[model samples]
Target: MGVSKMTGKFLKVKCGKCKNEQVIFEKPADDVKCLVCGEVLAKSMGGKARLKAKVLEVVR
Candidate 1:
């Protein structure tokens, strides 16, 4: 048996309005919003999210 590592991509973004940092999926099905502030971080565009804020890191 082999152990398979789960590989996934996530984006660490910061909210422009409230300066809140959050992690979201790169290709989100829906709009990604900030938990602290009611601001849209990324908007869903078919398959991927159109980032509306600054991206801090890319988690693998």
Candidate 2:
């Protein structure tokens, strides 16, 4: 099997409501709501940047 070139690290972001920390991976998304308090925690950026894939969403 070939190794996936698209890889990134999960980041720990603070929850806006509960102020709790959470971990997330590089995926396509708008913003992750806080699981604890239902408040928007952090947005998942397309940190898995790949030159091959154009569908990859870039957060910033």
Candidate 3:
């Protein structure tokens, strides 16, 4: 069998409240929060995380 490319990815995001840059999963199991501030950056949507912050870059 051949290996297949995965769709899931890591993302670089900036917190809306604190403007803190953070790295998160595309599909988070739980709510992703800012490291600097206690603000929700991404909300788990059972699939792809619903981003509450600004997406800076998409990590491979």
My TM-score estimates for the predictions, one after another, are 0.82, 0.47, 0.85
Pairs that collide in candidate 3 are none
Q: Least lDDT summed over 10 consecutive residues: which range in candidate 1?
A: 1-10
Which candidate leads in lDDT?
3
18-46, model 1: which lDDT tens digit per residue? 99999988788889899998799999996
Give the Å shift of residue 45 in candidate 3.
Answer: 0.7
- RMSD to the hidden true structure, all candidates: 3.9, 9.8, 3.7
lDDT of 2 at 48: 39
- Write candidate 3's Cα lDDT for 25-60 as tens digits: 889889998989989999999999999999999977
lDDT of each: 0.85, 0.49, 0.89
Over 1-60, each residue of candidate 2 has an lDDT whose tens digit, in order, gives: 134764554455566556666654545355666578776545445543222112223332
Give per-candidate clash totals: 0, 0, 0
Q: What's the true lDDT of residue 21 in model 1?
A: 92
Error of 3 at 23 (Å): 0.7
Best by TM-score: 3
